[model samples]
Target: MASTPGILTHWPWEPLGNFKYVLVAPFAVHSLYLFAVGAEDWNLTYLLTFPFMLWRMIHNQLWISYSRYRTAKGNNLIVDRSIDFEQVDRERNWDDQILLMGILFYAVHWGVDVVAKIPFWRADGLLLTFLIHIGPVEFLYYWFHRALHHHYLYSRYHSHHHSSIVTEPITSVIHPFGEHIVYFILFAIPMVITALITRTGSIVSVSIYVTYIDLMNNMGHCNFEVIPKWAFTVFPPLKYLMYTPSFHSLHHTQFRTNYSLFMPFYDYIYGTMDKSTDTLYETSLKKPEDVPEAVHLTHLTTPESVYQLRLGFAGLASKPLTSKWYLWLMWPVTLWSMISAWIYGRTFIIERNTFKKIKAQSWVVPRYRIHYRLQWQREAINKLIEEAILEAEEKGIKVMSLGLLNQGEHFNRNGEIYLERHPKLKMKVIDGSSLAVAVVLNSIPVGTSQVLFRGCLSKVAYSVVSALCHKGIQVTSIKKAEYEKLKKSLTTQDSSNLALSEKGYNQKVWLVGEDLTEIEQSKASKGTIMIPFSQFPPKKTRKDCFYLNTPSLVAPKSFGNLHACENWLPRRVISAWRVAGIVHALEGWNVHECGDRVFDVDKIWEASLQHGFRPSGLIPA
Candidate 1:
């Protein structure tokens, strides 16, 4: 089995690593200088740092993209290249949109600032303004930042940021443009509103605050740690009141706590801060559990049953298992046995419930046996099933199917049953013993989902499960024997001396009807046209094929005129009628009128090719 990617690893102790110290030092020095001298100039700061920030952000994205490409190309790297760039780009665009919106707001603020010409407000006549602004600005920043992580939006947007579990400086600003815009707007809003309303605006103070935030953000994402051990103890409840690298690191590591960035006060007040900060480092130092309880339970049993077993065991072991007498050994033995029995009983219950659920969901539909000897035909069947499921979902119908037994159950243990019971999904198992039945049942349009898995159930079961899952159907697994029988039937022929390859026999057929103009045909053939058909065309196309302009008389006659053209046309066609595109089109024009009872062109062509059907100029070499 492939090892889980390191990017998924969660370590708590040394969260921000060395970067935290690096960020704090510069920030502290700059802040002190500003405080002591009351410096007014910010141009030097912006000129020196903004370009670096932009460069770091771009460099990080390029590295990530390159890493992904290399991994896909089969190169080894420090990190797994499973990051989805398309998703990242989408998220980044959203962030950019938000950022642009924020810039607009900033423009409005600029106008207000000029019109009001507010005097700078300070706590100590001049300094108090800076402190007061920092507090509320940081507070608002934390609140909006926390809101972004809410479940409603995390999967689609914030997940991209979390994709880089191991933070790098570049990854810090790689948020979707929308999120960046929102952050900018929120960060500026407090300061802008205060300055406008109170007639006290300090460019120097706001610039300091923004610079501090930027440094802090970079430090939080820095892969190194810089904060000294003594600072936690010496800085007046620093560990509890102020944000540190470790605190921010915890936010990424756990993903559910430590939302505050500049301070821990808000998180503590809201009861969102994890109380195990000191223990986090210890936990990281300890050897990882050989078998995490969650993983084991998901693989072996349902959570409900696991919980019940624990409850029963606690009930049984409450008294002293070992006492200072003969009762000591006897009581301990009794308690252990009771606990074991409870565990065993719980497993049995889980298995039983699983089976019951499978049985309850089973239904039969009319199915046609797919000749599996033909690979293309089989693919056609799979494609049809995929489209049908999508169509059903669009029409508000729930399609259900059995999943791969072992893995399906494993996922269930992981608390991922939404796939099984999505609004447009459901699944049931056929008797576990009959793979043939399962496969046959799958082809029928029984619910809105029009596919099933039967033969070679154990071998192809996972494929079927994945396919159905991709189409949003819940799947379950049936018995092995049934799948085996189905497989044998699919491979065997009733006629003698008819040994067919699986791909040749099992290939599926699709009837595509299109009213193609000459340009449309050319474009479609070039794969540039997006037709109304639910199915997209495969990347490869038949070579040397000529377009036939024959009128197809297929019923449900919405398909205007059908055209049939063939590649590898014979060289010695004696007449003009035979070579003419119009005549050739007319030859097979009426085939579509037969509905689903059409002849197998691929099989017929294969037979003809074997029997010496030769083309002069059209043969694809």
Candidate 2:
């Protein structure tokens, strides 16, 4: 909203919320009904409104996805400012304009067709729209847009749009209802004049005109200067006819200039254009991709997880990955991504973040967790991991962490195979098992004497058991094989604290992993707590018992530009494994934490605290 919003600032159907789409139904149904019954020569121009409206919605969403992907990559970015949840919340209403547009299009089509029949195509009519748009629509919007910048209007209207100093493609359409009402009126001039006066308007021309407006609006606000310099150099006059992303960016940075709607002709003619527009455009185009100090190598968890990536829908990425029924509608694209991962396979950058002095990035392995679990897929998966390591080696990333199943014992032997393959590598490869063990051990409730350890043992499980035993805590396991495995790994002093017991129901605290069974959890007495030491979280079936998140901690406030959650973790919380990579880079550690080697648990825990990572949901018993 504006600093001081005025009348009609909210959409006319604002009170209706999402149900506002119900208003468009009657017009749409009426048009379809007449066409189906052949009740008089139908105005196909009006009838085509439904699909074109749908097309416009999709067009806007595509721009949103592209803009997010480009900005996350950090190349060709016109604005380097951070965008948080506040900006997301504020601009979420960009779709309201599309809703308003649907209502108007349906109403106008129905009204005009009632007076006289309309054609389906007219090339001349489309040309007229283009000409009128340049002559009157552009000229009028230039003045009207400038007028909105005046004190009275800016406070009550334009300020709402200008709130986003860093713009996304959708940011161009965010405005008070009063502002959109005027914008629609101006945009409708070309359509209305060509149809009513010239009598040459057709369904195709009207749709194309509106599409041109949407394209220009989304392009100018995409926050990247993608228009190549070579094109402008070839045809100098094109600069006056078309405005680039950086040109409009200057208007937001320096208010009261560059007020042209889409074309720079008026801004150039009236001298409202910013002097730095060309310089800003050139600089933004030349900006290179940043090289980070550390990288966390992660991967897609499920088939549906493609949309959960930072490059996917912003609304979904800001929260934890979850199944949405609507996602089923995207089966074609989802299938394509799965196939493309095999064909065009490579580790790709997901997002970038800064922690104090160290710059970090999160790179994805392009495969899902299900792929890692299959024995047949092991060789292929390892090759991808190896390629990613060599790529990071090429980039001089100080430390790279293997997250989730990327470091699975069965897949790559906790990322040990890479070190054996390339023993002389400079960059440190961390499985993060040490810090993960620390997170699980410290996460146990205080004063707990004995706890049941469940599930299959991994590198983390072995380390966690030793650390617990060293603290004189009783470690009991239900599976004899898992218990014996831990016993052999433990030292004589630590082994004394390890026990094989079937009395798991007696233990109140349950440290669990992959082989954790529902039957075992059910046997445990009510209120038994389970803390995951494994990368994968155990299924939660018992309601009475408390379940802690996988080994992770909340980051310090200094972790800036971080808005999206890490996988299933909550906002601002990070898994211990991923956090270990950043700590390694910050401390400039040269040692590798892969294979069977263990870092000092106490030392790793202390270093984690010193660097400002707090425990998540770890409460005293």
Candidate 3:
């Protein structure tokens, strides 16, 4: 364990394993003095140490990137790599970094006195200067970082930093220029004030402090566990004093904790240290072979993003010319959604759970599905949905499914709207409607030619009817106009005898159209069975009637639940959940938990597995 030079020599690169962090700040200060000021003054210390620090930074970055790629420990990474690289356009981030550096350092005309040439070694003065920088800077930064987490500030400023959960070297410096100005003012002002007040100020010391800060920032974002475990095991107190890549990574993944910059002392004092910080850090340090076969990374929007999106939604909904007056009237409802998001929409992670060889890690946005729908504000619903997909994609979610409402035919044509609108959203946006249709169709017995269609006019119901007819069932319908619409609409490829019949029906009935009571009243013969889409059966409904809705709507007795007809949701939800669960497990990708919270993939999987019954629909069509 001790003999490996690469492991021991690069111990600071490891997460939670480096105990010698105090030296890092001072060392960085010294190195910058050597590189930037070396040519001007020939000092023995400068000549010896300058080249090493410069090479160390570049070498560490290269080694970390190489190790992560070779080990393929992507699942264990705090974030997806694609987010750090692909999503953050290289040119833009580089431009931002270059601009900030040029303006802050080169572009500004600093007087010669700003960087002191005299190198004086004063042990007490050096220690005091380090303390001055650490104390006030940490104090001010804690508040500043916390302030940025606020809803409005996050969207406008801090969002750019949090954009890459799978952080990189550049991620350390990719702050919004506006945020940079503020951060610069906060950090520099305190150091400058401390330096002047102490009367031990030197350009060399100040440069060292700044260099120390930049080094720590890069180390915290390194995304590699270079620290050895022995450090923490040997001296437990070090955990509170030093920040690791895992510490900052936690801030990115779970934003509510570890906000302090260099040290976690403030985080502990404020009672904000994440409960799982130690455990998560340990988990991250595990070698690839030690972890599960598959690890999933989930993406969620910050509270600020939700608030911003909701406000945007309200604006779009309130657009007088573009939207319906009633939609405009729903401004209160839209505003209420924003409030709900504030109350409930905190970013969260579902602990990684494994099912056999596959692991499922779900990242959940706090906002409800209704927020994305814009609360009936149709004008902005599409845009909001597109933004949601883009957010997920930016977070590196490989596969995402939207709510049934968001992905319905009204909003999308076989996912074409999402595909066309967001060419950059490379992830799959599955509606699960195809699987839902398969499950719905499977509930019906095959080889039955004469079938009565109830909701033939509705697009979803029509699709079902068309599918049944294609499967060789002679589908009969009651809506004269809808039946004519289907007849005229069917192409040669979809040709089927979807008949309009007022005749007495003795065969099984597929209830999909509106006016369930009217259809029941108009039935010539007592149908063998009524397969309802969602609407509850009439009081006169026969005992054999079956409800075939996927994730069938639960109508409790308080809501006037009927006893005579059978609701298939009881049986249907199990199959649908299992299939989706298996898919999530097998693929280890993001599963969009849409619509009703009760029908989420997790709940469905638990219920389905407990029931221990596989419905016919598990097989994909």
Best by TM-score: 2
* Better-scoring candidate (lDDT), 2 or 3: 2
- Best-to-worst lDDT order: 2, 3, 1
Best of the two (1, 3) by TM-score: 3
- The models' CA-based lDDT, in order, is 0.34, 0.85, 0.49
Off by over 4 Å in 3: 1-85, 90-103, 106-109, 112-125, 190-199, 202-204, 290-621
- Per-residue CA lDDT of model 1 for 404-481, tens digit only, reads 121122212211233333433422111111221122123323353322222222222332333344454432213345
TM-score of each: 0.31, 0.92, 0.37
- lDDT comparison, 1 vs 2, better candidate: 2
Q: What would the per-residue lDDT of candidate 3 be over residues 1-621, giving only the tens digit for each residue?
A: 111112112222234322223334454465466677656544433333434344444444453334333224334454433331122342123223323332343222233333233244444455676775568778898988999788767766676667776665546766655666666776665445434455555445645665676667767876665556789899998887788877888898888799998889999999988888777677767745223222222222322222122112222211211223445445775567567654652333322333444433333344443454454655455555566566656665455544334454544553457676655554655554433444446557666666776652434455566677666667776668767777675665555667777664665545443346644644534435445442222233443344444433222122110111111223112223224433443454443432211123334434433433345322110
Q: Judged by lDDT against the true structure, how good is candidate 2?
A: 0.85
Candidate 2, clashing residue pairs?
none
Q: How do the residues 1-621 of candidate 2 rate in per-residue lDDT, one tens digit apiece?
A: 899999989888878865677887777787798899998855675576777778888898889888876776778989877666677778767778888888777666557663246577889999999999989999999999999999999999999999989888989999999999999999989888888899888777877888899999999998888899999999999999999999999888898899998889999899988988889999999998767888999998878888878777767777877788978989998999888876767888877787888888898888888888788988988999899999999978889999999998877888999999999999999999889988998888899999888878788888888888998999998779888889999999999999887665688888988567788777978778889888877777788888888899898878866777788777788899999999989988889999887767778889989999999994322
Model 1 Cα shift for residue 30 (angstroms)? 31
Highest-scoring model, lDDT: 2
Q: What CA RMSD would you report for each candidate?
A: 26.2, 2.8, 20.5
Q: What is the lDDT of candidate 1?
A: 0.34
